[model samples]
Structures are given as C-alpha cells and as structure tokens.
Target: MPDSVLYSAELPAFDRATGQLSLAAHHLISAPLSFLDLSPPGSTLLFDQPPAHPYQQPVLVDDQPRRKRRRTALPSADASPADFAALRDKRDRQTTTDRESDEHHAGIALDLRAALEAVQQGWAGRARDEGWVGARDDARVQWRLREAQDERPELDLVGLAAAQERQTVETPVRLEPPRAHLSAAQLFNRLVLNDSSSSSTTVDVGIETSRVEPAPPALAALLFPPRSGFLMSDLSTWSAPSSGIAALGHAKGGWDVVVIDPPWPNASASRSSSYETFDAYDLWNLDLPALLGDKPALVAVWLTNRVKFRRLVKDKLFASWRIKGTAEWWWVKVAADTGEPVWPLDATHRRCYEGLLVGHYIPPGTKNVALPTIPQGKVFLSTPVGHSRKPVILDLLRPYLPSPERAPNVLELFARMTLAGPRAPSIDPLPPPEEGKAGTPPRCGFYLAVGNEAVKFNVLEREGGAVRGWIRQSGLEKAEAAACVPEGQDVERM
Candidate 1:
C-alpha cells in the first residue's frame, strides 16, 4: 500500500557517482569499520581446549622393553589374573572420560543458546522504543499522500470495474493474413512514400525512441557491466536450464561476494502475487560452494523476521555452502516522506525492520585463518520503497570485503531487476574516460542474473535505462539526460 502514496519531495537523493541512494542518517553503515579499531577477541575458553579422544591409547616401547614384551606376550597360557584386571580398568577410565566430555560440550552449547536469546530480546526491546517507531511525527507523510490523491483521484471499486470493462471491450481481434501478401516492390514503394510524406512523424518517432532508448552506458556500467558480465536465468533451473555455476567459475577471480534475496513463500506474499515464491528446502539444491570458488568469499542473505526462516538460513543453508556466519545486520525501514517507520515497530502484520545475515565462505581442507570479526546487531536505517526492494549496501559491505580497492568480483543470486538500476542505452560504445575527467562517475561494476523479467524492468526504470522494442504505456515521461559508457560491454546470457 505504500506504493499508492507518492512523496517525491521526500525521496532520497541519488548519487550519480556511486549509482546509489544517499540515506546516510543510519549509523550502521559505518559501524563495521569500527571493528578495525579494536583487536581480535581471543578464542573462546570452551573451544580452546581439545575434546578427549574416544579411543584406546597406544604405548611406546624402548629397545629393551620391546624385546622383553615380544618374548613375554607369547606366553599367554600362564597369564596372571592381574593382566585382565588392568584391561578392565583401562576400559572403565575411557568410558568415564567420554561421558564427562559429552556433558561439558552439552553445557557449552546450552550457554551459547542462552546468550543468543538474550541478545535477540535486548534488540527487540530497543527496537520497540526507537524514536523512528514511537516518537516521530507522521503529519508530513499524511499531508503528502493527501495532496497526491487530490491531484490524482484514488481508484475505487467502480473505477476498477470500469477499467476492466474497457480493457475487455478494447481487446483487438486477430485478423487472418491474406493468402497472398503484397509484393516486395509494392511494399518498398509504399514505405518510401510514407517516409517522404511524414518527415515530422519520423522525427517524432526518433525522439520518442531516444527517450525510451535501449540500455545506456551509464545504466550498464552501474548494473550489468562488470568485467564478468551478468547471466539471467530461472533459479529453479539454475543447474539444468542454465550454466549459472559455469559462468561464475569462468568469471574473473570467481565471485568474491554473493548476495541473495530469495522470494520466500508466505501467506501475504502469496496473496499479493508479487512473485513466485520458493520453499526453503528448494534453496538447498543450489551449488553454492562451486559459485563461491576456491578462495574465501563473503555471502550475505536477506531474511524475513520469521524465526524458522532465519534458523534455516543460518544453520542448513550456510552449512550446505560451507560458509560460517559472522554477523547479523538489521535494515530498519522508515517512511520515505516523514522518515518514520512504514508501520509501528510492534505492528503484528509487519515489522519495520528486516535482517541481513553475513557470512564467510571457507573451502574444505583449507586453513581456518582468522579474519577481522564482523560487528553484530548493527542497524541500517532507510526509508521503505517498492515491495521487498532494499537500498544499496555495497558501500557498507565494501569494508568487509577482502579487496576494496580492486572492487571484489560480485554476484547477485535470485536477483531482482530493481537492484540492477536503469535499462542500458543501446548506442555507440565510448572509450573509458581519462583518469582525471571532471565530474566523471565511478563504475559500480557487478554481475547479476535474474529469473523474472518484471524485476528486470523495475531496475532499468530506476537506473534511467530503457528496454529496446518495448513501448511505453504509462504516461510517465522518459528521461532525456544520458549516462554514457564505453560500448561492446554486453551481458552474457545463459
């Protein structure tokens, strides 16, 4: 319903240089950087000591003992009763040690669970009382919504019915083609005459095409023009219908970071028909380890507030991918117009905050070298936009990446189009700008593969890109200003 309210005046400022929106009021964006200021915490006491071995101990023998033991061990016919007693004692000690170790580990696991619960509770309490939720005024948001509605009448049931009727009545019938079509000469002559007669019409068409032009360099550079280009395919058939994994493997240095925003199935999302949702179990089929490549990589996932979903992602999903979770970040959504939460903090149907779980991928048989610990429970505040559309967090994530300067080879899975920016312009390719060009924007080069075309459309529109051969139905005017980039940089579709 937030989409129905237009508050263009309060929209966040878009940074052309970064190809990202500036919503810097949130403190979480810079919190991770503070980790550099502190030393790494020592290993936990519970995990520092090794667990007792559950098998028999081996005895070493000296030269004299080896000869004596070999000679004495053969004479078992006259063995003493003390020999059997010694064996029984050893077995009993091993059993007792194993039981004690098991109890110790169980206690440690319980302690960790308690600690996690406490943290979650503390966060919930703070969120409930946060000013963005409880104290901020919504007068400005309401006023803007009212003004928008006044300028454009809100649709009611009657209007909806009338619109449906018009659509049904306006449906065009398919006319059968003539058995014999016009000859090529006749067709060519007619086209030439039409072109000559309407010079003004030709110019108007050209202008319209330019306005809704195919992908522009600026849009392509931001969303799809990474050295390793994007591959678009259905995730359900990621393994069969497409070479999603093969593409990643062929990418430059593989994917250094992968971000996934799954279309989680829920009653509300199902009713809205916004997108096709996948069962949590279905995600297990993805070959995440292969996509992560050989080196250590960062993986971030967007999760709903549901406890079961969160548990599944942290436990099963990450485990399958051979990734260990490092941090949990909260994305707190406020109103775009009033900078207040879209809903009350304690709203039963929807919480104003969603979660992002970040983890590191370490390949099997590799040394588990310690990386800088990620700060947990950080909050990123931003105004809500389209359904499930999250603000860009690449800037915030850059610090955590292995290489910030070279720009980590990034990949987005289960990607939505809105994340890709605007449609790219299909025009002549230009050369890379000189190092010191005044007002030249930086490149946000990243690869993306999406299943849904609708998602793709939304991203292009936001980035000021247009789809070729697609006619504009909405009254919204196309953007005239162009963002140019070097040409011949195209996405590799699978």
Candidate 2:
C-alpha cells in the first residue's frame, strides 16, 4: 500500500487572467461552445423544396393530346359478369376522388395549413429577437431553424414539438421550480421520503447557473470528448463515486475506478469564455451530495500544492463522499538532460510535480482495511516528455478496483478512452451533444504548442512560487527599514 504524504508548503498564489500558464494546478475544462451544437435533437432533414403558400396553384406545362379511346362493337351487349364488375370499380374510384377534393376544401384541412403557417411566423419572430438572420421567407427560415434544432441527439422529436407549441401558443415562457438552490436538508428529506428511489431526479437547472472560473494551465493536447449524456448510461466502470467534481456529476455505487485532475480554485483568476474557467458556476453548480450518495470503492483525484484546494478536497469533497484518506503520491517528472551543468539540474522548472490524491469510500459499518501495493514504501517517479504525462505504472492499481459484492455494476467519470480489456469495456468520455442543421464544425479545443522550449512545455509555467520568491528577495524590506529606524539610532550615521 502506498502511504499518503501531506505537503507542508502553502498553496502558491497565481494570476488567473492568463490561462495558457498553469498558475497553480491542472484544470479540467469542458468546451461548452464546442458542444452547443450537440444540444439539438435527431438526424438531419432533407428538404428539396421550400415551403410555399397553401393556395399556390400548380403550373401547367404545354400538354399533348390524350390518346383516342378504343371503340368496341355491339358484342359488348353480350359481355361477361367480370366486365360489369370492372365498370362498377371504375365508378367507385371516381366517387372516391370527388370525396377527397371535397375534404381538401373543407374547414379541417385549411385549419391544419393555417396552424403550420402560424408556426413559421412564430419562429421568424424568435429569430429576429435572437438576431439570427437565417434564410429569406418566414416559412423557409423557420424550417432551417428546425433543421438545425434536430441535430442534437439528446433532443427528442416529441420534446421539440412540444417546445414549438409552447413557444407559439403559450403566451409566456417561465422557468419551472427547483431553480437549483434546494437545501441539503431539502435533499435529505426528499431522499428519506423516497427511500426506495431507483432513479435520479432531473431538474433542469438552466445554463445560467454555472459561473465561469479561471482557466488552468494549458496542456499539450486538450481534448473535449463529448459523450451522450444518457441518464441511464452506467458510469461505474470508470469514475469512483467521490472523485466527481461539481461540474461533472460523480459516479455512485462502487465505480471500477475514478480518475480526475481538478483545477484547484487557489488564485483569483478570471476567464473570458465560460468553458475556459474552472469555477464558473457552469462547472461548479454540481450536486456534490447526490454524486457521492453511494460509496466509491476506488478513487484517484489529482491535486496541486495549493494549500486551500488540498484542504477543500480533504475536508469538503472527501467528507461528503464518506471516503477515508488512504494513499498520496507525487508524479515526479524531470528533463532527460537533467544532469547538464549549463542549466539547473531540475531544468523542467515549470510543472515538475503533480500530487495524486487517492482514497476509498467504504460501505456503512464495514471494517475493510486496505492493503498495501506489492512494491511499497518507495515513492513512484517517471520522466514525462509531454505535459500531463501520467505514469503508466499507475496501472498496477487496476486489480484492486472494486466490483459489486453480488452483481457487477460499474461507472467511471471524467475519463478518456484507454485500450480495452477483454471482460471489462472502456467507457471513456461520451460523444458531444448534437446541434442544429448548419453543419458548421465546432471550434478546435487544442491550441498549437509554439516556439523552441514549447516542446518542453515551458511556456505553460506560471510566474508563481519561484517568481514570487525572487520578488520578495528584491529588498523592499530593507528599504522599509531605512525609513522606519530613527537617524540617531544608527550612531554610525555620523
């Protein structure tokens, strides 16, 4: 078993204004702007012609003469009974055609067409309000909008149709209750009342609830793997129940494993885009209690040397999940040419170390002492050529990952795809939510690494701990002393 080590250093103060640098910690960012298109429902629509007026007449082209009818002799008077039946069928067909024409002209068909026309008009009004100048005519524009709406896989046709009806027919659109500030007491009460609750309650806390926080330092390749946010998808295979943060929900029950690298909220940094920030309410409005409602068997959370955030993970996050502190490890990365005297031994000065905060959430009243790893007592170290290079040696921890005592159910949260194992499937990040019909590709998530030492991930270093240390040594304290001490106190002043 790896022993947990606590750091005595205070968390470094950092500036959040500049995101390319890791002011203090590694932050997990969800690119919502890129995922916006994933919100609409359904497959794309194929529209060959635009909507026209209901009464528009079909244009008639120059027509050829109809073929002359064949004439039969007096033998027709002696025709078989089959011939009479054919004549009767022809009469019925003619009568049905007449009835269809009559139905089309009646009030019902006209009413349906009028409703469609009103829907188009309503959509046009909305587009103008939103400043989306799409398409020419009101009807055509609305169709294009609907086509766009259909792109999100999460949006069902029925829900969309209902939304359309409400937008047009219902005079006002007001938000419903559970505007997300439900107290802990309220939540506990609800849980108790519904003791045998099987499913999680979904209250639409609007997009506004998320407050953007500062962006973490940049990585070599930032990836936003969008998966189907299916309520029923089993998440236990990857993330542990307690490892989940406020933005991304946690895994409940015994997750096979939980892996996370959080953007510690240490510095007073702010971000321009909501997606870039770590604590923007968009990411933090998560229901922590609900996420850890069940005990997580295995967990691994990434931490920084930042003192405040480390305390937060220990006191707040862990306590809520009912997980006990187990082992802590440092991921040490040094430059390959670390021995060169021209540069300092620790040439990779910027992001040299990351702390892995590992723990386990046991069931109520269970006395299970976690055993040590086979090779223990020594710290694990690796030389990472890239930024955020996690040691593959950590894979040794895979075996102890928990399975259900009786039946097997697993979930993993905030994960990337790993090579698949035979029995267990790799449930990494889901696909991005679908968007509207425009087919415009979302913006790129990874910024290209530029310059010479860019390969060494140096530009991402923030001027924090070391830089602050240098500033403190620059003699502001000595200058203050000169002003404070009386001139006569220094008798040597003569």
Candidate achieving the largest lDDT: 1
Give the alpha carbon lDDT tens digit for every residue of 184-241 in model 2. Answer: 1121101111001111111221112235345332211101111111111112211223
| lDDT scores of the candidates, listed in order | 0.41, 0.28
TM-score top scorer:
1
Tell me the lDDT of candidate 1: 0.41
Evaluate residue 275 in candidate 1 and report its C-alpha lDDT on the 0 to 100 scale.
57
RMSD of each: 23.7, 32.9
Model 1 quality (TM-score) = 0.47
lDDT of 2: 0.28
